[model samples]
Target: MQRLPSDPFTSPLWHFVAVLGINGETGQLRPAHHFTGILAGLIYTARAVVAEAALPSQDRAAMADLPERLAAIRKAWLCKSSYAPMGYVLNLLLYGKKIAFETGSRLAVVWNRDGTLLYFQGRPLAMETIRQLIASMTADAEDLLWDGLLFRPRKAEAEAEAGSSSGRRKGLGLLEREGRFLIPLATIRDDLTQTQRGQSFLHTNGLLGKEKEML
Candidate 1:
């Protein structure tokens, strides 16, 4: 079996994956469709970082420790709030025995048995590329955040924006689109919904969306 990178903490990106149960060398659970949530969260966290960074210096210090803030937010959501339900879903997927890809197909999101991300089929994505993908996904997440925080956009406007982004993506090949293998949209949507629900629960429970300790 192919070995993954030696250092787990080498990238902040891996921290997001770890939150989803992918630990060092061995994953806490089997890989499943729910793994998409890690990707989504990575995207959101990366975008949130950028958003905070762009604020005026005075405002920036107020959010200077965003990663720690997000870490606490995620911990409460994953370990405390929805632990049982999330564990149940994880167990179900673990025992469900789904194939990762079609036989004879070289294209796939391959992982080591220990759950380390290997490559998309034959190509190894650069770390920067992975970060770029997260950044792109953050844009989508930002739109939803804006809608929730402020006034909602018209359905037509939302659809148009989504469509235009999709059109822009069409020029790129699947691998090039975000430097990661593409998951089915239905799967991504379901995963995203779960993540959003978790975030909502966190917000309601006073864990996120306000000034808080970086625990």
Candidate 2:
């Protein structure tokens, strides 16, 4: 695979996937678990740092070992991949933070200064994608924070009944919903539905408070 841009502002990019490890004996997102969201955060942070540093080269062989290291940590801690955005939403559950959208509702977590666990509707992430991200993380976590790639390889999925009245479908609690969101060149189209939806959310949420109306 070609090198992924470390800058978050890059227009053409891939969405990285992060998987949360669950307990085999018990079911819950563990804060102290070896594979906490911090690993995902740190990985991206490292990528950003590498991008900014005056580095010598971009090599794939070197990147391949990172995931192995991360997996070792997960195993050492006895954590299993829960298939939810637990790594992403775990921060919100721990601190009074937000993802600037319906993420909390979608992830099914509530907020408080004290510790509390909340249930969410989501699926486990694709193992391949998770592997890709772990291998991609370089040794530059500290500097990556400034470039806004601190949480790059994390995504959330939901479950719904076979059919739903509304377009919104309920997400499964612990499995990654299968299907490809990426558009292949052979199946490309001029449709702008996704762009419009993202824009609508930004507009509705006051992110573009003074921006002109976009159709």
Best-fitting candidate, scored by TM-score: 1
Q: Please list the residue runs of candidate 1 whose C-alpha ends up more than 4 Å from where it truly belongs after superposition.
A: 1-8, 12-16, 22-28, 55-215
The digit string of per-residue lDDT tens for model 1 on 151-195 reads 333244344444444553542342233222233344322233555
Over the stretch 43-117, how does candidate 2's per-residue lDDT look in tens digits? 465445444332224654466566565555433321223222332233433442233232333333433333333
C-alpha displacement of 18 in model 2, angstroms? 4.3
Candidate 1 C-alpha RMSD relative to the actual structure? 26.8
TM accuracy, model 2: 0.16
> Residue 116 of candidate 1: its Cα lDDT?
40
- Model 1 clash pairs? none
How far residue 187's Cα lies from its native spot in candidate 2, in Å, is 82
